[model samples]
Target: MKPGRPRMKNDEKQNLLSAGDNRHRRTEQEEDEELLSESTKTTNVCVRFDDSPSGLGKTLQTISLLGYMKHYRNIPGPHMVLVPKSTLYNWMNEFKRWVPSLRAVCLIGSREQRNALIRDVLLPGEWDVCVTSYEMLIIEKAVFKKFNWRYLVIDEAHRIKNEKSKLSEIVREFKTTNRLLLTGTPLQNNLHELWALLNFLLPDVFNSSEDFDSWFDTNNCLGDTKLVERLHTVLRPFLLRRIKADVEKSLLPKKEIKMYVGLSKMQREW
Candidate 1:
């Protein structure tokens, strides 16, 4: 959850994407092409946002790629996007706002409701993508495992930094052809965490943590030149970093209007 931000009320849910901005739309398209090319060329794609900022359009780009694949590449997906429970509807709204043609379903609610969704909607095989929470994925693993997913995306991917985590273990069991991880945090310092992410992305390439660790040992090294170089070489193909300043250059800096108020006698005492 975002710090200092209150939870969104049911009636307050709105389209996350900007409306009628041709320039922003063009920029998003260009970035989507880059993301599409990179994702298709490699088995695993990691979109890392260095600084979380509004209007970077990561969700839009991902949606666009799904749409492109469905229409242009002839890959009408049985895709799955696993997100936090709070942002489940946010993702659904994004899919509708960005790529309304693709059928996206949300797997949530009570047990009976979920059963109805599974019976009526999921089993029909009419949906292109399924947006669900981490808890739901675990609860319905049996049902999810039945399908061969085309794309499996995990937002806030750092939650699986530990290879032994329940979420990590469960997700690996699913039959997914393509995997994409979206994170709005840095993953540079911890080599083990980095390896865990890489292992998830390309299990064949980065299977051994011990070998990976020994190869880039930072012990007793002056500048860690070799380690840095190796890290770059390994990450260059799979990781696409979007810095807030770089992607949102056209966006204006937020203006803060400060106000000073005199404290009352009760306020001061408290």
Candidate 2:
């Protein structure tokens, strides 16, 4: 008779299944889940905010949730997350906290160090998410573009407002079907800057910068009452904006009271 392969113990098999089931379950807060749903439905999403009411934690959570959801759905990913150098560890920590089941690798440090990671980890597609700084992206465009990214999430997206910048130009080359921009300050300056962001998010839709500029200029010159309304209409579909006061009821506005007291002789002497 042929020898039979050894079977796993009942307890061991149950434990393995339990772990897999936990990873598949949805584990995001309701608001974050709702945001993820909206984000997944659209190709281009702008997460606008005046200030992070939840100290930017919710935004990170939403990103993590999306990554996890994609994994659970069996979507192919080497999702790219671009952030400022200072927040590299923060993003790594966020993924650890929210979705430990999915593997994440941060590509930073010296050129050799990053290259080693690219050879060992990134090229193999072992990681579910790849987090890197904008500087690294500019330097490693060729390597980054080699992958078919599922999603490209940009934090502090205002950095790309100037389309001519090396960073902006380089990132636009990445192959991603979905793009998400996270910014507390979405509109810092002119309308052209806004057009730059829209173009980055939805290149096919906002293909012509000249056309976008002409429309706004024509409307502005006429002093049309519909100018504000028209801008809102265009942005409403793709943008999700939230403020501190709206999301956090416990956070009350700071109150300042002025009081004057004369200094004692001993205090002045000290």
Per-candidate clash tally:
0, 0
Cα RMSD to the true fold for all candidates: 15.4, 14.9
How well does candidate 1 score on lDDT at residue 142?
A: 82
- Model 1, residue 122: C-alpha shift (Å): 0.7
Give the per-residue lDDT digits (tens) of candidate 2, residues 92-174. 88788877766778999898998898887877666777889999998888888766566788999999999989998888876
Model 1 residue runs over 4 Å out of place are 1-56, 220-222, 250-270
Local distance difference test values of all predictions, in order = 0.75, 0.71
How much lDDT does candidate 1 score? 0.75
Considering only N, C-alpha and C atoms within 3 Å, which residue pairs clash in candidate 2? none
Query: 1-270 in candidate 1: lDDT tens per residue?
Result: 211112233322222133332111123344465357657645443444444344546777678778977876666678899999999888999999878999999999999999999888887777899999999999998898767577889999998999999899888776566899999878766778988988888776788999988877657223788777777887888887777766777878878999999999999999
Best by lDDT: 1
Cand. 1 TM to true fold: 0.72
